[model samples]
Target: MPDQDLTVAVTGPTGDLGIALVDALERSRAVKKIVGMARRPFDPASEGWKKTEYRQGDVLDKASVKDALKGADVVIHLAFSVLGAGDKTREINVEGSRNVFDQAVRSRARRICYASSVAAYGYRSENPKWLTEEVPALGTDQHFYSQQKAEVEQVLAKTLERKKATQAYVFRPCIVSGPRATMLIEEIPYVQLSERMPDAVRSLLGLMPILKPVIPDPGTPFQLVHEDDVASAFVSGVRGVGEPGAYNLAGAGTLTMSDIADAIGWYSIPVPDLAVNATAEVISRVPAAPEKLTWVEAVRNPVLMKTARAKKELRWKPKYSGRQTLRALIDAWKREGPEH
Candidate 1:
């Protein structure tokens, strides 16, 4: 059975997904208290998180994380360092995770939920494909982000072998989307089309004939889950009946780059073989291509998650379908009237 009156400590509570988790836990009757930890002081006025206490803690600092984990029944480690500082990613993802695990052990926290990523699976070129929890890490050296994630998973697996009392759940979430999303076409740097494209772009592009590219093996198809659903899945994984392990939390249905572009009423452009083959070459010479291609591929080739375990074991159900979720994002973009 789950602990109903548990006090939960959520690391990275001020981030996009972290904020959403804080909000979900705050509204739950089962939760007694929520301890939100972050590097900067959380603004109550802007965050609107009530009945919660904020603590300033750095995951990189073991003492700081240990101090924050005091008296916490469950600790959800959501803090992640992606950009800036060369080794910050490994430091936060690996060393910081060790700190959290150490604190959980000291605090006698019953459960620990770690927010992992699909990047842990690394880059793959499989087909008719869906990545399951069983799929081993790709062991690719392409990016530091994926490498760190895979290493952290190995750390947790080894930790689990040593500790039996404390349960750990790792959630591998796909590209998360929602109303307040800062990614996608809107935030793409130098893509002035996001602003100058006009609201009529959706309708105007519909009339003009556009050619869609067809690739033989376009990788595993995936869709973005709403931030709310991702939060709910974490909460469910912590409270719901299940053994501690990894699970893929993704949106309903498999979608491809062409599918998403078509749904959003946009056209897909084929990257020439030269561009595809020499992506790194071009990225090295031309700075803009890296960011541009990153934005484009993020929407284009998302990895779909098999939600059977999440459904059967956790009884998790995504409230928003991928289509509806995308539509909401488009509507929100329309309301916001493009980037300033």
Candidate 2:
């Protein structure tokens, strides 16, 4: 049954997805209150959210997580690192997730919604062209982000199974895009540069086509779902509209690597599979290499998903197609990016 007039607790409620979710939950008649926990201080009223109460807390702090989540009927876990790889990041990704799941269960929350990624499917040579929820989430060893996502899912599963009273809805979204969430698009011009490089320099490079980094495109198609669509799926999870299981979320249609190059004003070039494979092979060997290199493996091996289950079960539909989402970002980039 879809619960109404509930207090929803959210971890990482100020992030890109969290902001959209906050808006959705604030406007929901079913949601009476929202308790948000983040490392930094935030005012929900700044975002025009009347029902949300903010708490300064870290996901790693068990006591804070527990205290912040008091009397929560639904819990949404959205806190995880994506760019860094080290003891701290891995600990936060794994143990921090464990903390969230444990507390949600301890509080006897009716539902838990976790934002997972298609990277959980992993960039493996063995992956099916279109992955379904039924497929195993055995994430590849290519990137820590992929590995940790899989690990967190395993933790959630075990905790939910043991508790039985709490249910979890796992949503696996593809490369998410929107005007507001420009993290991925911002990195496009800095592909060849070090991750530690300053953002100002990277933005300047993107402004000049000659200096812009060349992105290798093997012509593999990939999906980019709008961030709003992902928020909608989470809303479904919060409303208890879907069964307790994983659902793959993606926009209709697909875009190739060249399409991305065109979006950023011509930085795309056709690179042979052998070159990309050799680069990935080399990067994989350097265990101490920067986390950015970990994404190199994904260029050759794309993780595309089938959203039939989300549509059939949750009655979820993406408002924007893959092209529309990318196009919208391109429009926003013109106004906000280096070119501006």
Candidate 3:
């Protein structure tokens, strides 16, 4: 049984999801203390957190993984390489994640949570319109992100099934966005280059919408979950709200390309599906491509997830819709600037 006043361990507390989860846990009565490990130097006190302690460590190191997870009742794995390119990034995401999962099980954590992505389902045209928990994670061969996410989930599932003492709480969320999270918003070429001006010039141009350049809308739909909602769901897991298994997390609905463009004040012209598909394929193969390009593959065939399991089992409810989530991301970007 899990402890009523738990000692929670978190990997990647510096990330957007990490920050949100840590903030949520700080307010959670179930968590007495939160031990957070990340490569970046961070001060939990700066964030106004009381029960959280920040430690400098990389998930790639086994000793760090063991030390961070020591005496943890619930271990949450969030560290991952997103924008990094080449074989090194792949090694960090896949191998480092395996190390964390292995150590968590060995540490005898009562509840282990892994933040998988909808990308694990892959970008397949033949996939179901609405993927449920039952769908097999058939990862794509085009890029390593989806393939690696799928691979990690499969390995974790197998390991945890054998290690019955520990229960697996795998939450697969799609395109997390919120007031504090805007990596995708800042990096996506279409959104980033909408004005085609320097940061100074773009700010000046913002007042004149007619002078702004137009972006081509691919007509692809996507789901966006607020960063806070993601945090709340993980807190539910830490409290052992329901059965330990995979649960899909997303906003209540989907947002079209036009919706995203409107949120950021971009004038968009819809592109045919055929043209967009060809472009996404070419972009995926670009050497040293941005993480945005790899995600573009999913734009070709948007993966819409069904959050029924999360709602019914995890007792989770998302406060922001996909559209509202995107707006929050845009608002955050406008306030903080794109350099972040």
Candidate 4:
């Protein structure tokens, strides 16, 4: 059995949520040491993250993952490819996750905590308003990110079943937002343009009288969770509080496309679901467009997650609301360039 103080190993520790997780683990008394594995070394000067003993390696390479997991009591797998080519994402997200799990099990790590996503629940018109952990992860085939997350969860499932001694905790969080999510902001062109523009231009745009009418409607349900909140859940999982099953992690309130429009003093136009999906498909075909654009359509489904399991079981509560998290991210982007 693992000792009281845990030596944790994290894969992809340079990403947004990964940074948050490292911060959370650093503050926890249960964590004795942290080993971070990433393709490139994180800046040694970063506050709070300097403590992590980062292993310069890739998760796709099984030997490197095994080496990282050598003395780890728990493995926090956060490595995922979101904004890449379809095949590349599959290789990294799916195959890479498989390598991590296999190595963790081989290394005799007692537990594995995975960072799954709400997209794994699949974007369908028939989705329920509040999804729990029991909902099937039938992710849409059209979105490679969603599909890859679901596939990786299956790999985790098989690992938990085959490795009876090893426990697995999966957190399926919705739209994680924070200052560290720089790449995530790039997915929305308007936000990106607004953030990148000069302060005078931004002030001029803010003062434009008729701008509210032109704000594109976000005609889909949005559930935002702060990256720190997700990190807290992983911290709890590593501490052995939660059971070996999937938990839904989300913030307090919900927001719709119209809600966003109203918040920004814009007239909301509820676009038809089919039209949005079709438009997204067309936009994804453009050779120059970022693949993350397809996520716009993939997330159009009306699925709001119920985070009671995380609260009740893991004793995890999000400090920020969805709106609060969103506003903070936007404000941060505006103040600091999109280099999060």
Candidate 5:
């Protein structure tokens, strides 16, 4: 059980998962105060956010992170960079994680929870049918996001090995989905194209069967976890209920590119894996292409995992299935298309 009066500090507390986690904490009588550290101020309009004491801090800046974590009993490190080039993404994801963990140690925090991703397993055909926590997070070098995730896990592991008192909890989640996951939808290049066109033009374009045939097919098998369920796992870890170790987090279903297309009412043109990588290689050279595209080849490979560890250890049974989460995300995207 959690303490009756716990002061929890959450870094990157304004992101999709962060908001859900903070909301969960606020609902718990065990949590008395929440120190939300983010780069900007909280939304003044959110009643749920009003309860938190906002701290304007940057994880990239060690001193600021340390100051923000001073009196925290437990620190939930959610700061991450999902899309960017190598050096820029590493600056925030790798070095930034080190700062947070080091500061948590200096503050003598009892526990630290991290938001890791299944991408840490690395997208490869050789990946086992189901990954376990024992599997090292050594993603391929080409995928900076995957590489950074692995690097951060190494830092957390080393920190715990050196410090006897402090404990670490890492959740390697699959693609998380919910009403708040519109950001993921916006990341799709096709969706961005639709957003740029006029509304009438977009509607007309959607009706064109020929246009749908051109949609890129990302045939990789994947899993989806609800944002709320992930929050539950974190809450469980924070309350000293689960073992101090990494656990996979994902809902109870598997999906592929065709499933994603069906959910969003798009068409999937199945292409050979070789062709997909070839196209990605060409796009990598384009100046307009985001450096994050460097990982396209690696990510096209599937990395599936099971969540039995989280279920048995944390007693975390996700309420929403993977398909449910995907549907929710698609609906959210339709309602709030491409948030500025």
Candidate 6:
């Protein structure tokens, strides 16, 4: 039976994925009211979510976070920062997360769903034959984002140890792609084929024939789950239907960079070792790449993930395949003109 009259609080309500989750919850009859906390006020006309009550709060402020968690049955803490220098990352990702968890405990919320990242696993050279819930986290100090996620996970575990009754669920999602994605893909530095190459050149290369590529060589396997699937995972976690502790929320299928490029009706030539080294030098001089290639390569080479735990426990299934996802992205990019 649905948990009717359930009041849920979703932090970072205006964020890319947060908006989608709120929309889903608003449509659900199980939830009575959704308390959406964000830095800015909510816009009602955006989607006619009248049942949503907006609260302005900062996760960094313990008092503000504590107030935001009051009168909530479930707390979905999604407020996080991914930019700025080293100090800011620690401030928001670690300190802010600690504040949110502490408040969730204080409020005696039944369930707390945290949105962690696959980066918490750091990078692995030898891909696991099959990733499972039991896979130990191989965290590293190489990247701030990865390290911070690991630290936050530790804090939550400790908080659970202290509180004992509050059920803590951690979702370590992979490269998520969907309608309003905020990731490296959308902001990638690349020229449109139409702008760079003539139509004839595109045709001769068969780039326009496939519609999108299915798989490419140099096969650096990667996984990308749709945003909706991620939201559903959170909903399931809140309902106590999924694995209680940590689980990987990765896509159903895996594809290589060549495959992804091909699926998008483009071709990929492996950045030569020398070119990669030179590009690193250039990027380091200009601005650090959102995630260093070495960091990405460690995670991308073999993104082996198992969704069995999520499926059996949470009743979760991804509707979109990697190919379908890439096609949708291309179509959206063509129509929207990449303002996102």
lDDT of each: 0.67, 0.81, 0.81, 0.75, 0.77, 0.69
Q: Compared with the true structure, what per-residue lDDT tens digits does model 4 show for residues 1-340?
A: 2246889999988888888788888888888888988898576347556446888998888889888889899999998876673876678888889999988888889899999988888787667778888789888787777788888899999877767878899889887887776444556532333233334433433434344343344456678888888888888889889577899988888877565445444455545555455545555565555575656754466668999888998888789999888777767766786342
Can you write out model 6's per-residue Cα lDDT over 208-312, one digit (the tens) per residue?
A: 444333221344567777778788888777767745888788776776666555545655655434433444344454343434433434423455678787878
lDDT of candidate 5 over 286-329, digit per residue (tens): 56665746546544776778899999988898989989998888
TM-score of 4: 0.86
My TM-score estimates for the predictions, one after another, are 0.82, 0.89, 0.90, 0.86, 0.89, 0.84
lDDT of 2 by residue, 146-255 (tens): 88888889999999886878999999998888877666676532244333334443343343334655555777788988888888888888999968799999999998
Clashes of 2: 0
Least accurate 10 contiguous residues by lDDT in model 4 = 189-198
Model 3 Cα shift for residue 296 (angstroms): 1.5
Off by over 4 Å in 4: 1-3, 189-215, 258-270, 338-340
- Count of backbone clashes, every candidate in sequence: 0, 0, 0, 1, 0, 6
Go through the candidates in order and give the C-alpha RMSD of each one to the true structure: 5.5, 4.3, 4.4, 4.9, 4.2, 5.3
Which residue ranges in model 1 land beyond 4 Å of their true spot? 83-88, 126-128, 185-220, 258-267, 272-274, 288-302
Task: Write the residue-wise lDDT of candidate 1 on 143-238 in tens digits.
Answer: 566667788778777766767678888898877667765364354322333223223432333323324322211333556778889888788755
Among these predictions, the greatest TM-score belongs to 3
